[model samples]
Target: MASPIKLHQLRAFVEVTRQGSIRAAARLLSLSQPALTKAIKELEEGLGARLFIRHRQGVQLTECGEAFFRHASLILEELRAAQEDIQQRLGNIGGRVSIGVGASVARTIMPEVITRFHRAYPHVKVRVLEGQLVSMIPELRQGELDFTINTYYHASFDNELLYEKLMEKEYRVVGRCGHPCAGARTLQELMQCDWTLPTPRGSYYKQLVDLFVSLGVMPTVSVTCETFMSSTSLLAKSDFLSILPRDVIEDPILGQQLMAFDLDLPLPRATFYLIQRKETALTPMSAHLANLFRQHCRASA
Candidate 1:
């Protein structure tokens, strides 16, 4: 029978893979290089695969190493989370909670939410990666992100992930203050105007597509930018117009510089949702933060 893989072996294997050198990993783990090598060898023996190829320079992960790294990393992370969860449940707070945030949430709700979260749990680390919800899915699947508070998509509700609707967001096609197309009442009139829109894929992009399908004409695609902050900057400096959250104009600095066109057309509202892995229950600290987000979303609506 294959020998059982030990936690120490996994630690040594993963650390060596991360550092790319048995010597470097041993130093970090406070073990001798020979000991680290023995651990890696034992792990390979247990798994019946050569996980690493050692050379004079360092070491390289075999295909098995690459696959096993994902599993091992998740194991260590879950153990860490379990310990943190117990401590937090016992009224001790000092663990990290990572969440993926969309541009709209990052702008409006997050400021107050983060302020309150920090005040309540000063020692706990907060990782907020701001981007498109679609881009954060892989991280969410891998447990790198505890959860994501972002736009909901019908296709995204799968066997591996669950969604809870937070609130719907109204979007507007905005431009710089007093632009030439400011009086336009329809998307068709803005066909000649330079526009920066979301990239041509995923949920946000699909909504933009559906909006323009009936118009029989499309806005001039000057840029395909996803990050709203950069798109807003492009809009403010140039004649580029973009579909932005209605609350974006409420930004103190951006408000004075940008104006939303009051188009006669009804724009789409992006509904925000809390997304998490279906099988993995969140750590207590993460769950507390997630609840805080939901409460704030309800209050705003």
Candidate 2:
């Protein structure tokens, strides 16, 4: 039988894993090196595994340690969240909620959502992480982000995430007001024009590329921009085209310079969701933010 793990052992394990050295972890934890080492030793013994292996530089997590670290770190975060939740219930509302937002929701609803959130939780800090869903998954699994409000593409689903579908957003081939392909109605016609595709290699970009390849299209992808803002700017000034949800082209500010052109071809439709780790129950602060996002998406739809 394995020894029962204690909170002290977990804290010690997580810190040591983070600091990459026992001495540094001990300093951060305000404990002596021997105590930290003993805690780590006991943690490894309890789990019946060698958590770390030492080399000339420092300690590195073994394969087992790496797996344990994921759960251990999240356990610590959950405990912190629980303590904060109780404090907030007792009228102390002063914790941060970190979240990820894709362009679909952020472009139209973010300002209003933030305004509403600030009015209710004036003391709580809100951290908004911007990127495509593919880029933010690791953080979600690691509990760095409380949750995400974003659109889902074909490859965006993960076994570790619980996805609550919000709404389906039809996509269109978007272009500048005077784009040569502005009146284009076919994929082949749009393929002749330059495009500003997503820069992220693994997620949306790869999937888009895959779609293009499957359809016998090698779009004249002239430029690749990472953020929607940059790509929107690039699209507004040039003849470059991109596939965007209708709301982006219909955005009050962006609409001045952009318009969506229909195609006989069917574009990939986007479905937005409230995405979170399967085991993570969002703290009240974050849950409220997620609710605000859902409300906004519904109202807009």
Candidate 3:
């Protein structure tokens, strides 16, 4: 790769190109005309290109200089953003923070996250994206997402991201209201009916499967849905039971017509965590928002 271009040289070039004279550029830069000239000459030498023409009418950029200037401005702009982002991290102030979350957490925690973040920093914008835990890890590593809420997939992964347990949530069996098995007491009785749990490969799908396995029964799943809304809708239409988090099963709008019952054999209790890249430094706003989330969880607990 080529050596990085110097910012001083670019600034001098931009000043001279805009002002049309070394004397004018020097005045603007608070430097002597000879110093400005020398800087431009060094810049051209470093790049192995002639950047300007010295004409009596005034200076004009060579084709190479014009292209370099365009890129130089963009680099400077990005540098500015990086500097500001770091400063914001040093002390909470301003910056964009991107957070990814699982469907379950999004439903239970988003309102508090948004309300508290805005109350503290009205100027800083928070962007929340929703996805399964399976997609969150890759997105965080790629810098597409700054942080996320997920479970420890494995011991290796648990050591990779900075994971903090936020809460432990239990899965309850849910069905449309007035369903005959809504009042069922036994896991065997519930497992005999059709089910709409997540597919085995989904993020928390294994929790449901493991539950039935421990009971020495296989769930008679008739359909597998990827999202909570889809599975809930299926349950409302047919006599299918689903394993859902308490938040969804208690949602007034979505759960009003649904009945939730505790499993006779204990269902899996899943841990939800707040995670961020171990190597990435959190911006001030991001860190502040994270603190607020922790406080909210503590208060709720």
Candidate 4:
């Protein structure tokens, strides 16, 4: 009978794949080059398939190797979680929970959620990863993040994940306080003003463009920003206008710095969603954090 695969072999395979070379992986793993090669060879032989294509430069994963690498990485991550869980359970409550947040949600809702959670579980480490959903989804799938809170996109539904609607948000066109067009009551009047827009590549930007096009106007974009915080800061000190969610504009600190345009144009409503891998079970701490987020959203509404 074939021997069962060993943990060391799996570790070596994953490290080699990550480092993209046996020498670097060997240095990191503190294993001799020959021993690492032998471990990989044994693992491949045990599985009855080649795992990597050896080359003078390094090694590249075969199709089978790529598939194995993903599983191996996930398995190692779960093992680490299990160890941490056990350690926390044995002593005071403490484990790490990593979450991804979008720029808008991060500014509006995360403050309350994080403050309450940290106060309740001071020992537990919390990590917040901020970025666009496109950049965060891969990390979420790889089990690097426990969950993500972001504006919902239709493409998010294309992934095998569970999405729960947190709230429906309406956006307001905003500019610096006492700006020339802050009192503009019509879309046509506001269209002439230079706007700071979300990056043109994002779904939200497309929605903004579609909203303006439907109104027979093409927005004059002066700048594009990936985050609401940056745009809000710019709008505070400049005459640039940008669309922002009601919660974000109403934020106690941010609200003081900007004024909303009174345009009657129909704008797209944004829905925020809490997303997680459907198959992965959330840790107790992660589940608690999600609950805190839900509570904060409800209370704010």
The number of the candidate with the highest lDDT is 1
Total clashing residue pairs per candidate? 0, 0, 1, 0
Residue lDDT tens for model 1, 1-301: 6789999998998889889999999999999988998999888989899998889999998998899998998788778888888998899989999999888889889989988989989999999998877788777766789999887455633667888989988888899998998999988888898888877555655777777987787887868887877888898999998888888787899999999999898788888889898778899879989999999999989
Task: Order the candidate numbers by TM-score, best to worst.
Answer: 1, 4, 2, 3
Candidate 3 overall Cα lDDT vs. reference? 0.75
Q: Write model 4 residue lDDT over 1-301, tens digit each, in one string.
A: 5569898988999899999999999999999999999999999989998999989999999999989888888787787677776776677588799999877778877887899999999999999988666677767777888889876456744467888888777888888788987667877887777888776543555667767787788878878877766888889998888888776777778778887777666577877788888788887788889999898878767
lDDT of 1 at 275: 88
TM-score of each: 0.90, 0.81, 0.68, 0.82
lDDT of 2: 0.83
Candidate 2 — which pairs collide? none
Tell me the spans in candidate 1 whose CA falls farther than 4 Å from its real position: 18-34, 53-61
Candidate with the larger TM-score of 2 and 3: 2
Q: What is the overall TM-score of model 1 with all chains considered together?
A: 0.90
lDDT of 3 by residue, 1-301 (tens): 2345688888898788779888888999899988888989888888888989889876899999888866665455446447768777577477677888777777787788779789878878778887666666655654556688755455345555787888777777788888987778877887688887665543566656665677698977778787766877888888888877877778888777787875566667778788886766665677777887788778767
Cα-based lDDT at residue 208, candidate 2: 65
Off by over 4 Å in 4: 1-3, 19-38, 47-64, 85-92, 156-159, 200-206
